[model samples]
Target: MTVRAAQRQVVTERLAGHLLASGLSRTSVRQLAAAAGISDRMLLYYFRDKAEALGEAMGHVAAQLGGRLEAALPAGRRMPPERLLAEAARIATEPEVRPFMALWMEVIAAAARGEAPYAGIASEVTT
Candidate 1:
């Protein structure tokens, strides 16, 4: 990835971490940028707006979760319903994955409030 893309990923991950630690449902771009130790205008330059940045960040977390699920699937076979359900339960309840779940929920709530950037991300995660 390009340096800019890498920087965005770092910022997004930090923002998600901050939200999880603060138990916040949403965050302003300025607030996130401040917490991420970057200029607010830098955040705006990388992401059209707060919602887009948050969505991209949440997408990174979701991709990680998806990778875990893919690894857990049985080799050369579709994952059975039972296995899927068990994995879902594990992810939902596991402390390690809590931040990701929190970020996912936050993004979904944002999308519900007509946040266009997060709308597609929320749908993708639900499916």
Candidate 2:
């Protein structure tokens, strides 16, 4: 990969960690850039826009959450949708998973408000 791509990945991962820890409450370009230890202009240079940056970060969070869930409940273990949701709820209570759940709630609230990035991200999560 190019040096620029690698640097973008590092910044994206830092943004993902920040999002998981703090949710989407403070996601201005400056705030996100600060979280990623980059200048706001550099963040824009790395990503197309704030939506793109946030989408990539939340996608990372979702992937992390999926991996944690798969570890706790391995694949090919089938259950009814309701039962699966219950199991997920139980798993969400675990400390490691709780932050993701909190972020999910924030995403849902943002989606409900018809917010950009989040509405799209929440749809990606649900569907």
Candidate 3:
């Protein structure tokens, strides 16, 4: 990738972390720009709009989490069902997993309500 493209990906990931920390609420463009250390115009330049920016950020967050999960699984070894369950339980109790688990539950609840954005985001992430 070009240097500019790589730089943008890094910037987007930093923005995604901020967005994920806000829970289910939307962050204003000004807030996002400030958090990103850029002007609102620059933020808009990278994204079509706030919703599109949020979608990209959240998608980045999900991809990050999926990478973590993939890293945890062994390459070729077959894990026993009981061992898998035990590892799963351990992960659920981990500090790193707590926020994600909470966020996922919130999304599931929101999806049940048929809410916009999140309902679709949740479905996309899960699938």
For each candidate, the alpha-carbon lDDT, in order, equals: 0.74, 0.90, 0.74
Q: In model 1, how large is the Cα lDDT of residue 59?
A: 64
**Structural similarity to truth (TM-score) of each candidate:** 0.72, 0.90, 0.77
Q: For candidate 1, report its TM-score.
A: 0.72
Q: What is the alpha-carbon lDDT of model 2 when measured against the actual structure?
A: 0.90
Return whichever of 1 and 2 wins on lDDT: 2
Give candidate 2 misplaced runs (Cα > 4 Å): 79-86
- Stretches > 4 Å off in candidate 1: 23-26, 74-80, 113-117, 124-127
Top TM-score prediction, candidate number: 2
RMSD of each: 2.9, 1.8, 2.4
For residues 1-127, could you state the per-residue lDDT of candidate 2 as single tens digits? 9999999999989999999888888899999999999999999999999999998888888888889988978999888999988988899898888899999999999999998878988887776
| Candidates sorted on lDDT, descending | 2, 3, 1
Tell me the lDDT of model 2 at 93.
Answer: 98
Clashes of each: 0, 0, 0
Best candidate, lDDT: 2
Model 3 error, position 120 (Å): 2.3
